[model samples]
Target: MTSEEEGLRFPILIGDVGGTNARFAIVDSPDSEAGEPRIVRTAEFATIDEAIAGSILRDAPVLPNSAVIAVAGPVDGDAIALTNCPWVVRPKGMFNSLGLSDVVVLNDFEAQALAVIALGVEHMEKIGGGTPETDAARVVLGPGTGLGVAGLIYSRGRWIPVPGEGGHMDIGPRSPRDFEIFPHLEPIEGRISGEQILCGRGLVSSYRAVAAADGKTPRFTTPAEITAAALECTDAVAEEALAFFVTCLGRTAGDLALVFKSQGGVFLTGGIAQKIVPALRESRFRAAFEDKAPHSQMMAGMPVYVITHPLAALAGLAAYARKPDQFGVATRGRRWRA
Candidate 1:
């Protein structure tokens, strides 16, 4: 065995922390004899540190020296703040309290973006467009704890993840109903972001708007319920709501495609896309996706797929730990504890 393989013994702790829950795991090196890293228990705490403590208690031979956590929010340098949840993740302070050597905290979207580098045929469900070029830029986005957005730029035959707070971008309406709905939502205006209309709360709000448009009492429904009702074809209002949702998603996705000029394709991840694929496929999604102004046709040729693996982000964390140098990860602070 090569020294590169033999020297790989960095016991790492990795996690994908979102608004609702924090998922964690510990890996014993990249090519060491460690078995599959198991999930530590999830915590319902309000802060990242509390959640980290709970996860550590569930499974930890010892606190890890090298750790990386992907959190759902805009990572402003070392100060991380989540929009949907009440939590602030401070990497430097946590490292001191936890007695760890090194820790890297990245935007959850960034982590998901890194995870996209390791995606395979088994992890995806193709939705539309033709095959994409292998070495072109790819857009990675999804509706989750909030609408998370990121892009992967392939250069020199390697994938580089460019993370961003893209979900905070402005959202516009194309349909007349949407235009009418905009006024009632003016309170949100610039304050309201894509996450407000593209996430779970967005699904609920969309459903309510459609229902109210038909002069009916709005029925409370979860995003899952909205998707299921649409797929089952049991309610016309539900179907219409879903159609609008997909179209909006497509439009935002197209915007990202334009921003990145992603010829590699657009990859849709997160839990929400997996549950609503059928509705999305049948809706105005592809049409809206290709509705780019002058470059509409160009975008129509870009492939779009929904990632289906439940533990995809986990797999990404593993791959990143296995190849930190390959991922351009900068580990500041102390060295590995002996």
Candidate 2:
């Protein structure tokens, strides 16, 4: 194995860079337990380098010599600007800015995929479906500032993460109600993408569309407000919108499951899933998911779960940092060395 494949340097800086929040942790050694990550808003810093310098460097237990970062965009070239946020991340720039000898940048959901392997039953709640087949492929997706999708394949001796912009895939009206709401939902580049109905802003947009369809005004402007109203049964529009969100998530997840034939499982990560468990449990999510015709029986056996662990991405990075040989993370094009 190559030296880079052997391992990254100790005191490695691990990060999960999402569109809205960038979480960072320091793995001091192979046996070191990761502490609470230092989370800073993406809006608080113009660039990733500046965020690391301001939020992670000053208080890190020890200066890190290397890093493994997951970002919410395609991992290619040296410069990465997140798909949903404005901050740009330059790995070559991190060498002088963060004092790193090695840096590995990967798609954010790839980190989520890694976490799916490491996280145990306790960190997740099964939303529905049957047993997960051991060693089978797995899928993970979630709605935060954007919708992220990834898959995990257990190969000859290691787990490989497959990340893609599956969130941008086409979605359409499957139900009679969907016909009414789908037309009003906002679209990106003139067509409704999965992310158009699945992300944070998407929830608010869908809520507004629901209101407009019913000849009423939207009362909630944020995802949190809509979720709270749905949970409390305080607003009909919020309740319907939240339930619709759950259904869309289930359908999208099932679509991804079919894409990978992920019998291992489909994991729901991020805060939105964790917050709206009630709706997920009670909504038409399962029905919509299983409505895929002749393959419905096959999809029925695939488990769906809500990941409850807060620092899943960091946990994934630490695993990769601690034992690089265990996961076949493709760092060929993305890894940079000083």
Candidate 3:
């Protein structure tokens, strides 16, 4: 390696910017080159730019020109807008403001998908299906405040991330209970995306619907509380709600796998999926995932991985930074240049 690459400084600034919070890290060089990055602190800042600016000032004498940001938004040339956050991340603006030369912007889920390609069995919790194959196409979905979806295709001996607004797609009811609650939820139906029933807030909505069905007034609770109650088997309504949620997730994952021909596997990420692993294993998720018209065996053979790594997205950012050439731009084939 040349001195430019070899002498590249340690503690590169990396960030995983989400709607609610932005996680900043000072990573040492890649494992092959240097020691594992010791996190200075996973500082929480109010906005994406602020978090990044703060991390930069605190970690090094000056900010590095090249930065890869994993943002929960759509990447459009020089302009990027987050789906959930109000921050508008523009590469040109950041460049002019920070006096940087290169900035890499990628869809958050797309970044996650990239990281999934590098993830090993130890980094994941397998819920069902057989072993994962290297050549197979894979799907990565995360349910948080919103549902994020991305497709990973094997091409040129590397995984390519194709991010889409899969969460905004129409959500269909699969069971009688779902149908029964449909009219009551009509106020939110057309306006509601898959995020309505597939995210943290969606858990609250699910619990409310089930509570109403049981002839009990609906009570509000956070997703964490709901999951805890269901796990302990103390709340039958919560359990039922969670069961339905898992089934829906499975059905949707199956649909995505079929659509993308994700023979590689399906990876479940996000805060909610990690917490509800036990319930998901016990629910009808696997059965629902495999319950297709004529491709039941195909879904059954597909491996499902639940991402357990805390810095999975950051790992993706690092991977992108290390090999930016592999990303090869978006579908339109637009290259990012100053």
Candidate 2 clashes between residue pairs 3 or more apart in a chain or in different chains: none
Flag the better candidate by lDDT, 1 or 2.
2
Question: Model 3 scores what on Cα lDDT?
Answer: 0.72
Angstrom error at residue 295, model 3? 1.0
**What do the candidate models score in CA lDDT, each in turn?**
0.74, 0.88, 0.72
Compose the digit string of candidate 2's lDDT tens values, residues 305-331. 999999898888888888888898887
Query: For residues 84-181, what per-residue lDDT tens digits would candidate 3 score against the true structure?
Result: 77777776766566555555666788878987865677989998888777678899998886899999887786568888889877777767888866
RMSD of 3: 4.0
lDDT of 1 by residue, 122-207 (tens): 88888889988877888889887689898888665456778788988888766788886654332264565778778887888878
Write out the backbone clash pairs for model 1.
Answer: 71-108
TM-scores for every predicted model:
0.88, 0.98, 0.87
For each of the candidates, the C-alpha root-mean-square deviation to the true structure, in angstroms, is: 3.9, 1.1, 4.0
- How good is model 3 by TM-score? 0.87
Shift in Å, residue 60, candidate 2: 1.9
Name the regions of candidate 1 deviating beyond 4 angstroms. Answer: 1-9, 32-43, 184-192, 329-338
Error of 2 at 186 (Å): 1.3
